[model samples]
Target: MDTQFFLSMDPPTVTYQEKRAGVRNGKPFFYEDGDLKAARQKLKAHLSKHRPKKPYRGGVRLVVKWCFPRGKHRDGEYRITKPDTDNLQKLLKDCMTAVGFWTDDALVASEIVEKFWAERPGIFVRIEEL
Candidate 1:
């Protein structure tokens, strides 16, 4: 089975971060950054409205196309800015998991992610069972 959707919102440039730990009551507590949490929540809420009826179980291929507004950059140009491609995928995949797009993100055996400058900004996602 294949699933595809487009989120018509300017994608966040923030990314998931490594766990941060602190000692509280002599106990180590791990936490995520507040910006990351907020970004994830926003993504989850956007995706929940269009989540598939059932999660994909088998190995899957995921493609994410990120379109950023053409500001100083020319249209169709690749975005070579902060929040690298891999970092962007981290948050997106986690959000996909939260919305039940698949049983686990590990099921995503292959991924194609790209970012480009565009007249309009949004995210296009495609998932196919493999």
Candidate 2:
């Protein structure tokens, strides 16, 4: 099975890597920063609307295209700035897991992630059974 969709909204730049660390009673703990928390919540809310009827149990290929609002960069140009791809993908996969797109994100045996500047910002996702 293959599922593809485009989410129309400004993609958040804050990523999961922005976690904060603190010591509590001589124990270290990690927590998401306020910006990261907000970003995750926003993504979860949007992603929940697109959950598949059944979670993918088998291996799957996941593709994500993150389109950001164009600033000085030309539309369709690759974004080579802050918020590295891995960090962005981590947060997105977490939200996908929460929304039950699949039993677990580990089912994603292949992934292709990209970022670009665009006049209409959004997230484009394609999932295919492998």
Candidate 3:
């Protein structure tokens, strides 16, 4: 499949870039500590959900995608060239920063169903949420 179509399919909710690197979007983002900070913030909200009668005790998994404009960031790698493909590692890590906030966009991120990924790969940002 084409790269742009793949990345654009999701209409990324979280707007971010590598900590000190710029790419297709012509801007840099917080990637170095993005996962750590994102995970902490997400867990905070996850735990809050438990305060109420939330016996299920299930935390959601969020996926972060940073496909370069006109390119693809899949799996964990950025496909900058034509017919691009990668491991989406950065994307997943970035999503870690948005663990708890995933559901928050249910109303705004309309393509949530097609765009969301279930697991956090490469990085150990699992939110064994309480």
Candidate 4:
């Protein structure tokens, strides 16, 4: 099955790379930064409505277009700023997994991710079984 959806919100620039590490009782632990936590919650909340009834079990191709609010850049311009594409996808896929889009994000065998400046800020996602 194929699934596609658009989330209408400013795509958060915070990425999974924001996870912080600390030592507790001589043991190392990792935790999300406050901004990263907020970003994950926001993405999960938006992704919840589009969750599939059954998680995809086969390899899947995932496409994501992150559209940020247009500032000085023109609409549709490729965003070449902070937050690399891979980093952005990492956080998003984590949220997708948490929201049950798939049993595990490792099921994703292919990915195409892009970021852009846009008049209507939002995220566009397309998932196809492969």
Candidate 5:
């Protein structure tokens, strides 16, 4: 099965209090509220069960996604832009380095995309150039 590994780059900063003041202050995905590690595991389990229908080029293609109505805010089609031949090659190199797959010169700015995937903050999706 085609699969891609997506380890959150930054720390888990997703936080929101579901209860009112004095009720119970809380953090998002925290161990007390929920196990984020388990969430990742659950997500992986779900994916493994569904069996992706496309090929995984080490995260270099379209990842068809599904969203429930309540998650309208998270709806998006994301992908990193494909740079020119040399740039594309360099991007792949940097991406590997960023993900700890390689140890070459690393730079996040090297990845370029032709389309507007998303520009909002707190977003954790990137469409890789296929």
Candidate 6:
């Protein structure tokens, strides 16, 4: 696997699923939740700062590992929580697209996402051109 680029962001206060939305004027809209918005903004800023010189235009593979702060569970333990892995991917991919990590999130032909308990919580992402 030839990795095009990699990025790591400190754990965000709000997880992807925590982003709330509502209908206004008959149109769905994300709520102006300060914490959620701030978390997404922080992710975008980090991605923009570390984005590849040129966004990947071809088929790409994305690997995302989310490390959550350890609670009663031990480190490396898989988290069985409210936010599903797919839900988490939604926000992350959106942020990557916003920061121009790739021409489009659709360019990602393969994806692997996982969550685990850890002492140092963070998000680790790797992109490989396929």
| Candidate 3 lowest-lDDT run of ten | 1-10
Runs of candidate 5 exceeding 4 Å displacement: 1-34, 52-59, 71-129
* TM-score of candidate 2 to 2 decimals: 0.97
Candidate 3 ranges beyond 4 A from true positions: 1-17, 21-87, 101-130
Write model 5 residue lDDT over 1-130, tens digit each, in one string.
3234332222122122211233335644323245434333443343343333442335343232221122234334433333223432332333333443323433223343332233232212244433
Output the lDDT of residue 96, model 2: 97
Which is superior by TM-score, 3 or 4? 4
Which 10 consecutive positions of candidate 4 have the poorest summed lDDT? 10-19
Separate clash counts for every candidate = 0, 0, 10, 0, 4, 0
lDDT of 2 by residue, 35-98 (tens): 9889999998989888999999999999999999998889999999988999899999999999
Model 6 agreement with the true structure over 50-108: per-residue lDDT tens digits = 68778888998899888888878899999888468887788888899988888889999
Q: What lDDT score is found at residue 126 in candidate 3?
A: 23
Tell how far residue 52 is off in model 4, in angstroms.
1.0
Supply the TM-score for candidate 5: 0.25
Q: How do these models rank on lDDT, best leading? A: 4, 2, 1, 6, 5, 3
Candidate 4, residues 17-73, lDDT tens digits: the string is: 988999999999999988999999999999999999899989999999999999999
Best by lDDT: 4
lDDT of 6 at 38: 87
The clash tally of candidate 4 reads 0
Best-to-worst ranking by TM-score: 2, 4, 1, 6, 5, 3
Cα lDDT tens digits, model 3, 14-114, are: 22332334455776543445654554454344334323232212344333333333323344343343221122333333342344323332222211111
Cα displacement (Å) at residue 22, model 6: 4.6
- Which lDDT tens digits does candidate 1 get at residues 1-130? 7998888888888877554689999999988878777778889988898799999999999999999888888888998887799989988998999889988999999999999998788899999889
Tell me which residue pairs clash in candidate 3. 38-97, 64-91, 74-88, 75-87, 75-88, 76-87, 76-88, 76-89, 77-87, 77-88
